[model samples]
Target: MKHYVLVHGGCHGAWCWYKVKPILEHSGHRVTVLDLTASGVNVSRVEDIQTLEDYAKPLLEVLESFGSDDKVILVAHSLGGIPAALAADMFPSKISVAVFVTSFMPDTTNPPSYVFEKLIGSITEEERMDLELGSYGTSEHPLMTAFLGPNYLKNMYLLSPIEDYELAKMLMRVAPAITSNLTGTKSLTEQGYGSISRVYIVCGEDKGISVDFQRWMIENSPVKEVMEINDADHMPMFSKPHELCDRLLKIADKYA
Candidate 1:
């Protein structure tokens, strides 16, 4: 049995993986779904997460608890990719493979914030819709935060089930928009984060991330392999749970 660590995106928590977790566990794999800082049931406030490391503390601690001989398949969704990359960098040997599911996949060459900046740049003002972006900290060291709006959530879950969408509306939290730590000059090293095998899953119908942007990221930071869930939306765990699980299982069979 392989171990799978599922990481959720901005404004979401472990609860978002409700559909996918049971399926993976039923298939005899150990699935650990995480709620990043300030997300899900984690009590930390968004204001407390001043840096990328702060936001990723829970995930880092979880990875640290693994025995030296153990390795996991790290699966990151959407904004969770940045913290997942940080974990891979800090514990390369602990991760057999890092699967980016319609998530931002950073390159070793640029700072971790590059992909996020690209996304912001690509989005038009109208496209931003009701999604709320706020700032914290002083003007000299400002930090960003985002809260997904109801209408925006609708777009994100356009193809997902109504029940799952309701669950998200009930559980979503405010998330840091990258944070100052990611804006720093540090980049992932080839000997660290780059050492792990990486795979990218494209959600073709996702309006939240957009297929065009997802493909662009794939080209910008090439991965070991590329897979597609053509009918999936941004929330594939809800929109295409079984298909996502099948792809994950196939990846585990080959890579883990």
Candidate 2:
């Protein structure tokens, strides 16, 4: 069976993948989902994450535990793409391909934080809604955090089921704004992160990350292929799980 590692985005935990996970497992694939530091059910406080490395600990540990010959299809959503990129860079051989689903895709030409900064710049004040952004570290080493407000969550889950929306409201937590830790970090290496195959899955109706921005990202850092779920919002896992799974299965067949 092919292995699929699903990583959730900011302010979300592994629980967010509940719908998608079952479908993959039913198809006879091994799906591994994890909670990054201070996210989901992980007990660590957000303050404990001071750097990108600190935030990516859980995923890195999981990758490290695999056998040298073991490789996985790394599927990431939203902000989860940053950590997924880091993992691919560090363990290129361990990743068959990195799939970014309505998520930020970084390039080897800029620091890991470039895409996030572009996102922030593109979002208008009204578009940001009540989402709260804060800092936990001092001026010298500023660490940022984001908490998704109810209104902001609504827009993100507009096309999703009400039950899933309620579930997110109950489980969402304060997430580390990875841009802070990645500020001065060097860009991904061509010989490492660039060597891995990449794919982009666009959510055509995503309000949080607009389709324009998604296309911009794809153009900014080109990938091997691009797929779209025309009616999906930002939370396709909850809105279009079957369609999402179909695309994922196709990727597994081609790359895994």
Candidate 3:
């Protein structure tokens, strides 16, 4: 059995992987679904957490439990890519593969926000205004300004075909302003990425992240695996957990 660390994106928590966790465990693999500080049910008041380093602690602690050859497959979604990349670099030999699930492929110095501007469309003045450092306090992260609207079916089809309206509703929250921390990706690239292999999962119908943007991301990312999901959305774990789990299991099999 192989060990997997599943990281959730902005506005999400370890709870995001609830549906997929069981499938992996039943298949006889070990999985740890982590909730970064201030996300999921774990978040209390905003004041409870102050920085990204604080959010990354639990994952690092988990890494300490293993030896150099213990390979951990890190799967991150959306904004979660930032930290997962850093963690992979931190415990180089311990991490075999880092998977981005509709997420950014980041280097050390790149701010998760910086990648967003490059891969997705250019930042609008209004959007820039909303996500500006002042908008969300240096202490808080901002959630998505806009989402796939309520065409209901059509909306989910393109971006997050994983979630239904009700489930999608609970999954959202105000992300912290710590996105500014992503400015460090350049330094990360300077250092070797170490022993990790990267896999990029691109969802074809994702209107929120967009195929063009996703392609830009793939080209710039360090990894080579680009798995396309036919009609999935941003939150494929919500829309198609079963299929996602099956694919993830296959990836795990290769490493195990």
Per-model CA lDDT versus the true structure: 0.91, 0.92, 0.65
lDDT of 1 by residue, 89-172 (tens): 999999999999999888899888889877887788899998898988666778888999989999999999899889889888
Note each model's CA RMSD in angstroms: 1.0, 0.9, 4.3
TM-score ranking, high to low: 2, 1, 3
| Global CA lDDT computed for model 2 | 0.92
Query: Which tens-of-lDDT digit does each residue in 1-256 have in candidate 2?
Result: 9999999999999999999999999999999999999999999999988777788899999999999999999999999999899889999999999999999888999999899988887788988898899888887777788999999999999999999999999999999876836445699889889999999999989997889989998999999999999999999999999999999999999988
Off by over 4 Å in 3: 44-51, 108-113, 119-164, 181-186, 190-195
lDDT of 3 by residue, 30-65 (tens): 998877766777645434444555556667777878
Is 1 or 3 the stronger prediction by TM-score?
1
Q: Which pairs of residues have clashing backbones in candidate 1? A: none
What TM-score fits each model?
0.98, 0.98, 0.79
Candidate 2, residue 149: the lDDT equals 97
